[model samples]
Target: MRRMRTWCERFLRKRSSRAWFLTESNRIACVKRMGLEAAGAMSRSPSAKRHTSSVSLKILVDMDGVLCDFEAYLLEQFRSKFPDEPFIPVSERNTFYAHEQYGSIKVELKRNITDIMSSPGFFASLRPISNAVTCMHWMRDIPDVSVWICTSPINKYRNCVSEKYQWVEKHLGFEWTKRVIMCKDKTLIKGDYLIDDRPMIHGEEQFKPNFGKHVVFTQPYNCNVTTEWRLSLWPERKDKLLDFIMFLREGLAFRD
Candidate 1:
């Protein structure tokens, strides 16, 4: 009995060490011992399953630049608020961020721009990009396509967060307000395609392990970026958008 207990204790210690190591092979073995299928263990993982023919094509659309004329509105508000302060025209914008462009002229100008953006009703008052609303409605009506507004609220979330919901409600309708996903790290969100104006969604320091194909929404700021899935004009270039969606669907179907 003493020898058997010693053998059991040694076996348990070895098992504990393997568990502590947590290697991929050890994890699988441990899971199997626990009576769980190794494959089934990660059934709920984001990248576990690819979209089959029956599965809807999930497309994540950005709010500010893609849906609404964020830069135009910001310029208008900045000019109205600070008439004398120098401003960069929308056409002349090169950098991804508006404040970065203003920083070159005057350091204090960054704060001015920030104040305008973070102010209440700023997002709500912004006008929709030409044909953006119409296109959104059209996309929503497409069969087997799931559209979602994936946006990030400014750091000054006090007014920015609530106003974003209001803006969506006002423009995209009340139902779309529910589709709004205010996330800081968009990489975590799972979608087949992400239509965004920004060149890099998750910034430089972080690794963006997103499963979606980034469809760069053409803007003066991100004009330098060259992507096959670039969306320039809404409704007019909507054919290209449809083509991309169909291509992805066919590819996924073939893969499945």
Candidate 2:
């Protein structure tokens, strides 16, 4: 009995030492990830806070179509420039856009966008889709759910970064802390769902990971998406955007 007690004490000491070492190592790793070495770097936000931030979300939103009505603004410019070209309303525009027909309008848009992005009148002409802003605001009220604005601005349009922030402030009436991401590698950021216009941005069907479903936004240029849940405009589709927001809100509200 004496020998057995001694052996058990030694085994517990060894196990306790190993456990302490692991805990310390994990602390160091977390500190490094939080940039403790960087001057003025603060501790990482608590997991709960990060989960509720604009970065993490049960539903991530795409900037161009899901949030901003980029295509509508472009179509407005097209109609203004070529009034005789039978340019249709952005909602009515089809996906059969060809360079021969739309090349000049595209060029004009590129120029005008560059010119007006810094101007005070930029947001006035931005013309966010009918129900996009309402949907975002509604989602903002959901508890612990995030709403990230993921987008890929062309490298040539570097001004879009600041312009995007400006647009968000003007339209949403609030400054987002870290909700905006301008990148092509959107899947790298964790999300439950991506509301986007690009079908190819996310990957193939059968090869999908556990990430979430891809909800496509219909655009005249992006009609060939390989996804099923496409929307022309939430308002046109009988408050489907609201329905999606309500779905996400309910999904997160009842979680463990």
lDDT (0 to 1) per candidate: 0.70, 0.52
Q: What is candidate 1's lDDT per residue for 150-220, written digit by digit as tens? A: 99889888988888898888887899988988888888888887889988777432365363777788899
- In model 1, which runs have C-alpha deviations exceeding 4 angstroms? 1-55, 203-208, 236-241, 251-256
| TM-scores, one per candidate | 0.73, 0.55
Provide the lowest-lDDT 10-residue window in model 1.
44-53
The residue ranges of model 2 lying beyond 4 angstroms of the native Cα positions read: 1-57, 81-101, 104-124, 202-211, 222-226, 235-256
| Whole-model alpha-carbon lDDT for candidate 2 | 0.52
Question: By summed lDDT, which 10 consecutive residues of candidate 2 come out lowest?
Answer: 38-47
Choose the strongest candidate by TM-score.
Answer: 1
Could you give me the TM-score of model 1 versus the true structure?
0.73
For lDDT, the strongest prediction is 1
